[model samples]
Target: MTTVQPTVVSAEAVDVATRGGAGTARRRPRGSRPFRSPQAQELWGWTFVAVPMLLFLTFVIIPVVMAVVLSFTDYAVIGDPEWVGVENYRRILDDPIFWLALRNTVIYTVMFVPLGVLVALGTALLLNRSSRVVNLFRTLFYIPVVASTVATATIWYWLLNPQSGLFNIVLGWFGIDGPAWLYDSKWAMTAIVLMSVWSGFGTNMLIYLGGLQGIPRELYEAVRIDGANAWQSLRHITLPGLSRTTFLISTLLIIGAFQVFDQAYLLTKGGPGNSTLTVVYYIYNQGFGGLKMGYASALSFVLFLIIAVFSILNFRLTSRRQS
Candidate 1:
């Protein structure tokens, strides 16, 4: 048998090999630092958002809070403010002018909201089917929105003049006398409402158009295949689908109507015995003309509350209807 000699094992050699392996393993970079914790990531995200949040709070939230506080005080620009509690609100409650303004605002909203929605929906429907000149028609409709309100109001003022207005001229051709539009109290608000509707309908129309496009085409096709007529399809599918947009548009229109000032200010100046005095125009007169800052703030707060309540009611009604 060949001489079987055990290989000599050296302590120094084993130690050297073990130390070398350990050194190599320690020198190799770990694959990447373990991913940052979710908590850390969330902290960084909030840190980035803090700046915009601060700006919004500073500009919007603080102003609203300040207004709310001011609403309860008797503040004049040149004097110290006196806390009056709910006196301003009581005064508003008893003021016939305030009631008139409120009534006018309501009338305007009731008349304009439905009319605006109807016109916008009609325009959107017509445009939805038009492939050619659709953009052109949209631009045409949107022109009034982009145009200067003052300029539009001025032009309409001229067009509704009792004597030389184009409308009256047309009325003359029809052997009918055109009533004074801006001069007559009865027609002043009506004329302004008409102008406002014309100016504002395009915005709501665009919104409705977007809503219409978002609706799935397959629904219409299915309804048609099921022998549904256009009116039925519109009633069941279009109305239901567009409900949210309708609510939004109507709410916005109502709010806007309550704040009607520019047209009234420029065209009628709340003339014909203040028949066209909107709440905002009243506040403006109080604040700027009469220099009743506190009173104006109070009026503004009242308007704010009205808007809030109306919005809440609208939301509740819409929710109930949907349910």
Candidate 2:
């Protein structure tokens, strides 16, 4: 204790030592700073985005650019692409098969979109009440959406079989002869539309459910207090509340309808005189089957324009209604 002479610490030593103990001075390098600098932040941000941006450029942008360039040429998956100006696009106008496919696609959209919206809304309305059984039904209905499209097409193929099928057998109970569904051109597209609606409506139903939940319970309570019936509440409150959701679902339905391929391809093969030949299927036939890549690209662009126009129209109509 005596040896621990009253040592006076120098200001320099005190400055270098931590409060708890003496240690080596830990000064940052001259002009160096923490990572909070704007330059550092921007560096990290770019590092995060670089991979995704690269991928998008590689897969999406490059392919789209290539398709545009190829659309103006004659590429048949063989030899060099020959420059053909707008010959492919001009050919589209004179192609009766193209017009037929476009007509079928429009018909399918008209039937599928409205029916899909109604079914989704109706299911969502029915299941809005919270209950375990209702949750179970929701899960069951969504199963079809997750199921393989090929499997769904296969199931419907048998279901619509003319001689020995569930649909015809059920109709016979009412003393009604069901038409040959996939075999007859008249009913083939209708049969495909029904299958499509059944397979896809579950997704839109979930979307409607989300929209329903977002509507304030207070609104429903207020309507009920004023003696509003269920239908009246639905008409005044529910429908209006779900208008945006309806528009979104309808737009998606319209796009998918225009791109209809799987069911028509699997069940009908555009058969019975190309009754169910959708635009996408025709595009496929030209691209791969017929090996006319350039024409397929032109058709694809045309379809894209159609989908864009319809989606824009849908948005405008929805906005007008909301206003």
Candidate 3:
């Protein structure tokens, strides 16, 4: 039988077809570009972020800058601004109402933040065990979180009414006279603070529950093996594990407490001689009610500074504690 042997191609012929016989050299299409370098890739990455950066500048940075500028002026809504320098700030510092508002804000924050954290932690501990009903209970607790603050405030206002109110009726059983909650200067802010704690605790509770669940069971087992009781396990293992979540929740609650307005507004209107007047409430009255826009801007920026300082301090403390 006759067999055909395959022809061996010459190197020169292969080079003509493949650009080079070494099989390394190849020409790309004319219009195509090569891969980017690391620096180029990073430039492109930041290019993609340009739109978001611009949006943030427009929405947040510009508005803040404008407010700062306005704060240095005496601008009302109807007229042009006259530059007043530190006059508005001086007025704020000298204002007794401002002092009262600050005091009330501090009191409200002190009352609400710890109470909210403790309540959330306690509730989360109680609900940490796995069960089908736990999810249902979680949803029930979360209802207030999703509900409107105005609606909740309105409901609480009625419930806290001194005469013919459910809260007083409950207090009546103990033969205690329930003071006018929203009407009395003594009880108005306290009532609002309590309601705020109740309304907000659910959200923090869910967060703590998540944190608790994330801890490995083996750690608890090891603790038990070491003869650690439940309290010891919680203190050494659970709490330390939950540090990040606690820090985050506490920071948020503190900020929220400082910015308290809705409950005070809807329930008390900072009434009974401005006793329950919070910083934000005062800002609202100054800007909108009194039409001192420039002065209000100053007040707002002061509040912003206060919140920023506290938030930074909390973060630093939390980081130190964690480390």
Candidate number achieving the greatest lDDT relative to the actual structure: 2
What is candidate 3's lDDT per residue for 28-124, written digit by digit as tens?
4454344547888798899999999999999999998999999999999998999999999999999999999999999999898889989899999
lDDT agreement with native, every candidate = 0.85, 0.90, 0.88
The model with the greatest TM-score is 2
Descending-TM-score candidate ranking: 2, 3, 1
Model 3 TM-score, all chains together? 0.83
> Candidate 2 — which residues are off by over 4 angstroms?
1-33
Q: For every candidate structure, what is the RMSD over all alpha carbons to the true structure, in angstroms?
A: 13.2, 8.8, 9.5
Model 2 lDDT per residue over 1-323, tens place: 65454344345445545443323324534564433689888999999999999999999999999889889999999999999999999999999999999999999998988999999999899899978899999999888898788999999989988889999999999999999999999999999989998998899999999999999999999999999999999989999999989988988888888999988899999988999999999999999999999999999999999999999998998889887
lDDT of 3 at 36: 46
How many pairs collide in each candidate, listed in order? 0, 0, 0
Model 1 lDDT, residue 319, Cα: 72
Task: Tell me how candidate 1 scores on lDDT.
Answer: 0.85
Worst 10 residues of 2 by lDDT: 20-29
- How many backbone clashes can be found in candidate 1? 0
